[model samples]
Target: MSSQKEKTSPFMAKAIEAALSAKSITSPNPWVGALLEHQGQIINVSSTKKYGAAHAEAQTLQGKHLPEGTLYTTLEPCVAFEGKRTEPCTQIIIKSGIKKVVIGIEDPDPRVKGRGIIQLREAGIEVQIGDGADEITRLLRPYIKHRQTGLPYVIAKFAASIDGKIATKTGASQWITGEKARDTAHHQRAWVDGILIGSGTAISDDPSLTARPKNLSPEQFTQPLRIVLDGSGKLPVNSKILQPTGTIIATSPKSEKNWQDSLTEQGAQIIICEPSQNGSGINLEQLLQVLGSRSILSLWVEGGSQILGSFFSQNLIDELWAFIAPIIIGGDGLSAISTTGTSTLAEVPHLREIVIEKLEQDFLIRGFTGNWAP
Candidate 1:
């Protein structure tokens, strides 16, 4: 009985919930949701399931006859057959007897951008755009970013002390946050397409970096692609990362081929990138482009500070999620980012906090790159 633009609209809330269900499953294509209200009653609610499967609107039409009603979709339905998988969703909606359509946002992708809305309008269907835009945009941020710039959406994650240190000066960093925070981090890892860590982290922590947390069954979890930024291809042969299926070790061209070849034989994909501008590290932009070409839509970087600093320096981080433990280890510990040439307060990196919550003993702070606050 209500349009989708209202802040507290039930239709918008249900659509968002439906979209969230597709997390960890849909990549390359943003998660989408469709809800149909027929005769003042909710008839169908559907979400995009997989990459090549039926889209939300098409799924909603499954086994149901056309009925006069209003349709709500998190994104504008596609009108053109531009994708690799399914047919246009606008045709399905047009074939149905839906009287009105409310959309969250125009597709950031150029192919179906506003043409879907135009097609619906031309077909004598009432169309309302930009309903629940903020929530839907946040939900589709990774896809939107990838469509705009041919690179994966990057999120930098870290767990640090209250004084902003990831580890002590001796590099003894472990158990900074509680179990709940660690579980939360694991869940975050399960949501992204890839997980990245620096060689320093690989050597220091010797972590598996898989999404299998504690009692969670392997069938229930989706392990992200493991990526290591080892500048010289120095990942040890005994490292736990080699045990995984989709493991990539990115290094500079100057790295030794002997160890690289050995690791390649051990199930690691070696990506030899260009040297950095300073010639001390691998080029970060080039690494991102390589991952982008491989269809990595969203990436999370859990770091040992230096790799996180490189991404920060390049302004490549789209979001930052940190768990701040209420402990002080002020004895020359490693700072979150290794001092990025900010001399004055005006030059400090600014971030907008989107979520700050107390998860047991630690505080989880999630923010974006810009200064805008919610």
Candidate 2:
């Protein structure tokens, strides 16, 4: 008999392709795809739907009665666990009369981990793993990061001049990049679960922080949640971000109650975070934990130096997107990133797998930080 790996390879590719179709639509839950095959013929293919809905396997097998077949899934089928919102996919697959199962990767979630595979095996179902694990891992990076670290996958984005300055000495930073780069940035904003900025950016830019890509209609994409890191609660109550219902203000315990209440009155949620050990700002890790608990799997950080520096200092950033304009700003201009306390070249975070793209006259440089892959 041929190895199970060989039998599963062809189906895993189709399964991964199906999963990619649901990208950016499923948050908190990993976007998974399922395919059912019988006698070398494709039966059905399904991908995950919206959050809090049926999983890929359940969607594919539910309400169907068929002969024994092989089921290919991008992720391990989930078993019933406490606090689970939906029915377990493992049970659904067993009931659907699937005799063999092919999984791309085991879920990193502690709740299900290897238990789902064990359950299938106990039911006398043939299980095989691998083939498209790397692709699935890349697609589920945010979800896996959240499950393992209790922190959202962070992507830092910024626009700077050729001289690496974000703003002129006078703090004029309106149109650093061309319209094409800005539009691409908006599309990225729509892909993430949240958009974050420090208080300095909040005060200086006063941006609306909404994802409004010109090519996408309002109904086609939902606006990401806006988050402001205001340790001292200095963000003005009238800031454009505060006008949105999904805005969150992360403040330190020292913040004024009146200011927090005023922000709350504006329909923004206020989360009290512990102060950092350096006494500079609210604890970023703690704030990330809160975001993870709330099911924010991915976050985009549009910074004003300090926030970018903080995330770099803590090694929290997974990816970096830098848009460099052709113009040059003088030495007196503000730098794109503040001091990160790196005294040596080796201490500086080096990005890998660098990719460059041209957005009209501007150039976009994208890379992964640390051990991040994709």
Return the top candidate by lDDT.
Answer: 2
Model 1, position 191: C-alpha lDDT score: 81
Worst 10 residues of 2 by lDDT: 1-10
- TM-score of every candidate: 0.93, 0.90
Deviation (Å) of 240 in candidate 2:
1.0
lDDT of 2 at 295: 85
lDDT tens digits, residues 301-326, model 2? 99988888888877788999999999
The global C-alpha lDDT for each of the candidates, from Candidate 1 onward, is: 0.84, 0.86
Over 160-273, each residue of candidate 1 has an lDDT whose tens digit, in order, gives: 999999999989888899999999899888889899999999998899998856655655446789999888767798899888655999998788989988888888999999
TM-score of 1: 0.93
TM-score of 2: 0.90
Distance from true location, Cα of 287 in model 2, Å: 1.5
